[model samples]
Target: MKFLFLITFIHILPQCSGNPLSRHHTTSEEIKREIARYSDIAKAIINLAVYGNAQNRSYERLARFVDTIGPRLSGSKNLEMAIKYIFNALQEDGLENVHLEPVKVPHWERGVESAMMLAPRSYNISILGLGSSVATPPEGITAEVLVVTSFDELHKRAQDAKGKIVVYNQPYISYEETVKYRLLGAVEAGKVGAVASLIRSVTSFSINSPHTGLQKYQFDVPKIPTACISVEDAEMMARVASRGTKIVVTLKMGAKTYPDATSFNTVAEIVGSKYPEQVVLVSGHLDSWDVGQGAMDDGGGAFISWEALSLIKELGLRPKRTLRLVLWTAEEQGGVGAQQYYQLHKVNISNYDIVMESDEGTFTPMGLAFTGSDKARAILKEIMQLLQPINVTNIYENGGGTDIDFWVRDGVPGASLYDDISKYFWFHHSQGDTMTVQDPSQMNLCAAVWTVISYVIADMEERLPR
Candidate 1:
């Protein structure tokens, strides 16, 4: 028995000795070679993106386009118009085979929304109904407000929440945690027979404009009216309630939901010369919330992607693999557009060389998160070394963005470019997200990063691992 065990251990040790993790590590020599190969191209793309005359022209055109179109909520007529505009713009940008794929999306109308305190220090407050929230009666629901910091606290005192407006005054910690209250606070409040629900805007900044996002209704509970008030208004309500005063809130919202409507995911491709079957995909969503002009939330991202491809073509660089640009719709409502695209093209997942998405607001580019095998990541690190001079240096392991989740799950490795998100969440889903809020210098920096990344992926010799 001892001899048999010794033999098995010896065999396993030799197998473990051949582990790739022990042998395959990023080396300075490899990085230096990659930098030498791509540095000139990276420098050229960066110059054009940040300081070139062409970039200025593109920026002005994009800013004007977003401003003119204004808000384009999912499945709305404005969104349809925006889709058409994007297709035309891509065609004009010299991209071939620009087309739209049909996708079904939910339609939620934000007709009118208002809320105010009726006791203590009476004040009108800015608010907006969360997408998919049920409308209050014609007269609106007036009830004493009950404030809680978390769902656990609400669960603890749920019995006392009857006939009151449950106000979730939870502070924003991170997008992962704060998003829970925005997505499901209504259902939690409704389970306890609350008349309505109001969540503090999911942002750290105390702007007076409310942030709006998608909300979900549980099947077992009645759907209650839900809205979000700005952090300032939420604090004021909390203060009034703390004084032991009967804080009555009058909320009037005409928000309602309609049947799913037809939307489209627009795609434009630059066919490759040698490896026509392999693809490098880049994109941003086209739909935005109804409050602002949708400039920073996604308009900037979409335009930068469009401009990057245009610049690549204008530079007369013909890639070896197909380069595709997608302007997805209904990303705000859900990832319906992305999911539909993935399903419609599931057979091509293996042929995708790399997918890159830029939905993290149009701030200065930092680096990129890679979600793939160590082999693919090692190759990506090589590419990243070329971008180091431009200050894009925060590559790490992470999943792809929401729209690319489908591809990533199906073993298609992808990346979501990182940007300086220090202030992005502040105005992310709020009316504060407008073209006026963007800094041209920072936007230019982002454009530079996008151009380099798109070009590298397009020209790569090997496809990323599946």
Candidate 2:
């Protein structure tokens, strides 16, 4: 069945070679030989990283860094230290052009914040102020609660939300779908004159822990204090409100945003042996929320990206095109670092061969999500087959990371590591994102997958079609 699937896929998909005008060179025989050679090398790299001395060390290094640095919120000193740490580590590893590119990032500090259920049996609720949220009045606001699941419901019951605290008890269908509430809860609630808002944490399951994330308030709308509450608390409020019991809550917060501060996106590269100016880039965001150690959220992503280059350099392998590692800062505040990097490099965008990012947790390797033309996709399909030994053969289209969105829009092929995120959202922006959730074997496998794909793509005779 697998063989039949492969044969059918190949026949249906277009092929690409060194140049689009010279497609005749991408015949099956040549592709097969290329696949065989690269597959052997990739398998060897995977085995060396997973079963050899490199095993477990990647996770250990990441744990130590994250534990030592703690949370690396944008514009914080911790973030700068993390960048310096990676920059020095890359230099010590002998990678070339190890440097930091400047980017001014927003500085949001979460001061003392708390929420309490005042009626229907007093209960202290776990909460974390959403990023960029306004603080409640000095004494805080105590008001009856308005419970709604969806934005449509919020609109329908807009009249009832006036002078009340809107509590969004939305279900966690998926991160992409559920996060909409967290991102726009304040704007939606404020539009209806809500004094404050609390959103159900964006996670399938929670342990009475609230998750904090970035939320934006529309300029035209009134800005209101917003925070996330644990799933249990959200559901309990919803049940109480259903019974027509007035749910009163007191919300107090000291969240504040200051002037943008200077930060950096750390970059290091392994120069190519042949196409020196051409580049294959692998990246991950470095800045994270103030909560937790930021380990799984992005420390894992950034370190695994670093480990890819580290392993390649250690093994004494140089590809045809340069391999660049980018640890973007201020990503938690809406890709500020990445946007600046894109604007600065937009003129030379064509020089980028491919850009890959690993922002998801470094869980077991499930393959990659790709964004490119059909010809490029075909090449990727062939490349993914080499990862089959680790059960990472999946590759879908129209996928990449937030940091690479601008480049992908500019017609550059982009990719993001796909992993089993079944439990990622649970700890994602919460205090649960410590190093305890990481697995050493999975980290090594993630590094191996990233290394092989990047090396093979950089060494390929042609860049992926734009």
TM-score of each: 0.91, 0.95
The lDDT for every candidate, in the order shown, is: 0.80, 0.87
Q: Please, what are the lDDT tens digits per residue for candidate 1 over residues 201-282?
A: 9987865878999999999998999999888878877777778877888888898789999999999988888777778888
Q: Which stretches of candidate 2 lie over 4 Å from their true place?
A: 1-24
lDDT agreement of model 1 with the native: 0.80
Model 2 root-mean-square deviation: 2.8
RMSD of each: 6.9, 2.8
